[model samples]
Target: MNNEEKYKKNIHHIHDKSYKDLYSKREVALDLFKNISNANWSKDLKAEDLTLVNNTYITADYEEREADIVYKANINNSEVVFYILLEFQSSVDYTMPLRLLFYMCEIIKEYAVNAKHKKYDKNVKIPAIVPIVLYNGEQVWDVPNQFRKMIYNEELFGNNILNFEYDIFDISNDEKLNKDALIDLKNVTAAIFLLDQKMDAIEFLERIKVIALYFNSLSDAEIKAIKKWIKNTVVDPLAESAIKILEADKREVELMVARNAFILDEMRENAKKEGREEGIEEGRKEGRKEGRKEGIEKSKLEVVRNSINNGLNDDIICKIANVSLDLVKKIRQECEKN
Candidate 1:
């Protein structure tokens, strides 16, 4: 890839890495799962029972797809795969269900291969996969959650058609994510979600102050992780002006909050000044146009008056002065009265 493409890819990779690093923490992962709406199955499960599993899968087309997070957990005496798809795109993926299906099938195929199960082996027990998509996009996710919804004439096939519904956690949407419970639980993942939702740098910086309150409750390692994520995903992408103010005092979250209060007010004043300058520039352009138009009208009236004084006939004056015959007549009548 060229430098620009490589830069974009690296930026996207940074986002993926930051998210992977945060969720890989057992505490954060467990907290996310427990907060999933109608997820009573995970209520009885503990941290020890949840094992991180391989996420890279090769599809039938020989294309490799790496899932964000995958966990193996025994729920109700059955081995189940919890495939958490961390989606950070700004727009909704229309083929979300199909993407989930492809990943799930690959997971099952890998499971069968590892277990040494024959093609038609009835003795081999396939692990049930609970595919969950965690989206932090700006737009509301409008994609179909069920695989059957993507298939044509699915209703006609009835039970014969393969179908499964994936759970979606729109982290930006409070209705989808139990924000109150997660906040009450002091989950770091909730803080990440809340920060990710604020696209504006000022709003993001403001939210960091609220998130800082949880630092005392978190471990040093967790605090470090949050800082790293912010630097890589949030702060680095900001404009140089904002970055200067934010980086004024060692870039510490607590220190920055205190310094930024004054900085924010100054930034708002600068924005107002810029707006006023733009309005003045626009008004100057309008004024110039009006002046030019008025000058042309005055010149036209002068030509009509001169033609009248030259004793030129109406039709000749109309052609020479480029004024209408009616205007020539009006000028001549005015001269007679004077």
Candidate 2:
């Protein structure tokens, strides 16, 4: 697979693993549910009250889709199920509301089928479903939260239109949950999402050290899974070098010091190389007396375009091309139009 696809796959894998690892435990799941849902009933519920449902609703047609998580629990003295859908794509999906609506319908249909097999009374109440979308993409989620919002000109239909709103936990924004209040695996998962958005190698490594403090409390298997995730999703060369240093040591604090030093050295080397290249390019441009300015501008634009095509971030492209951020953004916008 290409780098972009591999990156996305690794991210999804990490997310799936981390989520299941934490949510499978009743205590952690209860805390997470209470924090995210803010339901009055969750305040009095214990871990023993929750039960995981292993039913798979994904059909052959939807085989390409990731399996969503479901949990059956008793809340407020009533039976209910929670459907957790994860969206980690770089861009927002406008059809998410419709997709969730379809999934909820399938879940209810399955419940009905099972109820029939049990010979349930016609007056029996159906279990309520609470759907949640956990999104961690860099872009803001601007899609409609309610199914009715997806319908065109819903105002005309007024109260006749069907509607249900799903809860969203957007990790990109800090307004959702207080990360400091979370414990153990939940805190580490939040740190992972927060660190993923940081582009600086030093800052990322420093944050990783904070996450490592909780590693000693986790099982060996969990540690291995998290380490594997770091190796896969963190593709920055400087960050990779720091990870290598950190992995060599056992003590978290010592490893943090070692990683910081390694990152500094790597950053310096990269900066020196960039400077040398810039100097060489400048020398070459100066040699061409005719159309020198135009040639330089054309070369810079070409470099920006190539970097964008190669999936480089704006900061890196700006530094490499020795151009302003606005120029890089303009070129990216123009490229997108084409």
Candidate 2 lDDT over residue span 1-338, tens digit each: 75445645655666555555545555555655674567755676776778777675555764444446676777555554444433333346687788777777887888778777454565665667777776656578788888899888998998899899877766666455444433234443454454555254445555566556544554454444455556555545544554564355555566555656574545445545554555566668665443455555666776677657645556656766789977877787788779
Supply candidate 2's per-residue lDDT for 169: 67
Identify the leading candidate in terms of TM-score: 1
**Per-residue lDDT of 1-338 in model 1, one digit per residue for the tens?**
65445644555566666777777776667767785444766687776767777565535552322336677776555555444444334346787777777777877877778889777876757776777776765578888888998989888898888899877777676464544554565556666676666333445556566556553476656666666666666532232323443334434656666565456445444544554555555557777556455545555566556545533335444654566756776776688679
Worst 10 residues of 2 by lDDT: 81-90
- How many collisions between residues are there in candidate 2? 0
Q: What is the C-alpha RMSD of each candidate to the true structure, in Å?
A: 19.1, 6.9
Worst 10 residues of 1 by lDDT: 235-244
- Runs with alpha carbons beyond 4 Å of true place in candidate 2: 1-28, 59-62, 75-90, 117-122, 177-186, 213-232, 235-255, 261-265, 268-274, 277-338
The runs of at least 3 residues in candidate 1 whose Cα sits more than 4 Å from the true structure, single-residue gaps closed, are 1-10, 58-67, 74-90, 118-123, 178-182, 214-216, 237-258, 274-338
Candidate 2 Cα deviation (angstroms), residue 197: 2.9
lDDT accuracy of residue 165 in candidate 1:
85
For each candidate, what is the lDDT? 0.60, 0.60
